[model samples]
Target: MTIADSPARYGALSRFFHWAIAALLVWQFGGICSEAILGEDHPLAARLSANHTQVGTILFVLIVCRVVWAILNRGRRPDHGPGLLGYAARLGHFSLYALMLAVPTAALLRAWGNERAFAPFGFPIFAPRSPDQVVQTATAIGSNFHGEMAWIMGVLILGHVAMAILHQVAWRDGTLKRMT
Candidate 1:
């Protein structure tokens, strides 16, 4: 397959980004769900959660790249449609992209404002924030909406998968093939 997208289908790069992000999202949510099930203090939960920051950091970087690539190939990609389904597809995708960025952004902001060093994979990205001065805004944003928005993103993703299945099964439109 080609590296750049074409009207008929997504190329190698797009597929890589799509599947990579999807796998990482599964890892991310799997960790959360596992923690909830096994108890946050369980050894299994701890093991999964230990890499959360690192994975999220990687995801943020990749999502940024994905956005840029998508824009570069926007004209060559498949169209959503002209009707309501198309509009919903457009909106759902936009929401997914937005949430993909927003969730990690909230975590990064929180880490930046944290009293401890912001380290992902043992590399310090942000030095410790001043003990005397707390970034209330950043903390509040992270605390208030991070998890909630993540769950909302989950719902959007389910819809996305459902649409893909619908296209592949019911509609037989080969929509799933665009990024396959």
Candidate 2:
């Protein structure tokens, strides 16, 4: 069941998902940044890539939980910001959810398409098909779209962070407080 009223504060599950996602994003950003600076051949780059994959898998699961939670608790309003700002916030959030779902789904398809073994915890989610047609098609589509989406996500995320900083520093708004 979901709460229809405005939340007094984020519930325990909401808070956990929010903070967990935040931490994972931080780790992801760090890994991405390090990879850009250190080059792909560096030891740190390899480690970061492994870390990125593991954390991304966790993010995929967390996002699924978050979406389910959000669907169930549809009526609870978040703390309000300025009118235009609120619209932007909503847009940003929607974009975030779209990218979160799309990116991972694409990556999974790409992996499966290549007939690559996905041994997350030593369990295979999909069995190998002798002729992997769906995976092959998905991998081609996913590679192109995923790169484009990644760029879009990066811009939106930067904007989101900028807005949060603006709220905290310039406006002294409580926008960041709700999530923080």
Clashing pairs in 1: none
The residue-by-residue lDDT of candidate 2 on 1-180, one tens digit each, is 232324545566776787898788778767776788998788887777766667878998999998888777766757555698777788788898899788778877776776666657667876665563556687797787865776677788888889889989999857676665
TM-score of every prediction relative to native = 0.96, 0.85
lDDT, candidates in the order shown: 0.90, 0.75
After best superposition, candidate 1 residue 33: deviation in angstroms? 0.7
Candidate 1 residue lDDT tens string, 1-180: 799998888989999999999999999998898898999999988888888988998999999999999999999987898899999999999999999999988888887777878878888798887877668888888878888899999899998999899999999998898888
Off by over 4 Å in 1: none
lDDT top scorer: 1
The lDDT of model 1 is 0.90
Question: Model 2: runs farther than 4 Å from truth?
Answer: 1-5, 79-82, 129-134
